[model samples]
Target: MNKQEIGTFLLRVMLGFTFLMHGLSKFQGGLGNISGWFQSIGIPGFMAYVVGTIELVGGIALIFGLGTRIISVLLIFIMAGAILYVKLPAGFMGNGEGTGFELDLVLMIIALHLGLNGSSFLSIDSKLPNRKRGQVSDKMAS
Candidate 1:
């Protein structure tokens, strides 16, 4: 495909894979432990499971380019929440004492780009009949 298409595909794959791993790690480490951590941070403990499941499912959808815009938006919310609640106070460098929002912000930007652009290439959205070969597609709108 073209460079832009390849780039978008790569971004989708990377974001999906990263989140998939994170979700898997949370499961492997025990949901209770993750829930406890969330509770400690003032978030409801049950939200840990909900967020983990969403990340896992959303990551798969992203890799396959299914519901890309919606998935991107959901993932964006997760990243934004992370930045606002956990990382923003730590500053840019992360300094070992606490993590920083820099990574979360980068992920949020990528998610926002995908949300606005839709799944440009190598995606199920593009393969659907509603999307024309050369037209600008708002997959969700269609």
Candidate 2:
């Protein structure tokens, strides 16, 4: 419940919701187009499914504070790919050819922070009755 915890929770929720929406959009708006776009970008079409699943699942997990660090790591990889493959060519401001990598960079940084620090006491990981070593919880933090 400290400032850092509150900030982390906000970041976690924000990043999670963002990924959730993107993942949901990929499916709701039709993965066929996403798959085609991936293929066009030189990535395997099937990776669309993999990325979508990870985003959706990872988003939910992050929101609930379950496996926060692991999920954050996965999200970091996704953002990296996005920046490297798609957004970099678009320039920092998009330059009129799709969106830029700024947001991706931000998200990647958030994920990096989560991966390094883990989640707050409000997380399920923290609430677990018996936690493994290295896991941070309210009591453990105290």
The lDDT of each candidate is: 0.86, 0.91
User: What is the TM-score of each predicted model, taking all chains together?
Assistant: 0.86, 0.88
Name the candidate that leads on lDDT. 2
lDDT minimum window of 10 residues, candidate 2: 125-134
Residue-wise lDDT of candidate 2 within 1-142, one digit each (tens)? 7999899999999999999999998899788889999999999999999899889988988999999999999999999999999999888879886999999999999999999999865789888687667899897689
Q: Which run of 10 residues does model 1 get worst, by summed lDDT?
A: 131-140
Clashes of each: 0, 0
Clashes of 2: 0
As a TM-score, model 2 comes out at: 0.88
Task: Note each model's CA RMSD in angstroms.
Answer: 5.1, 5.0
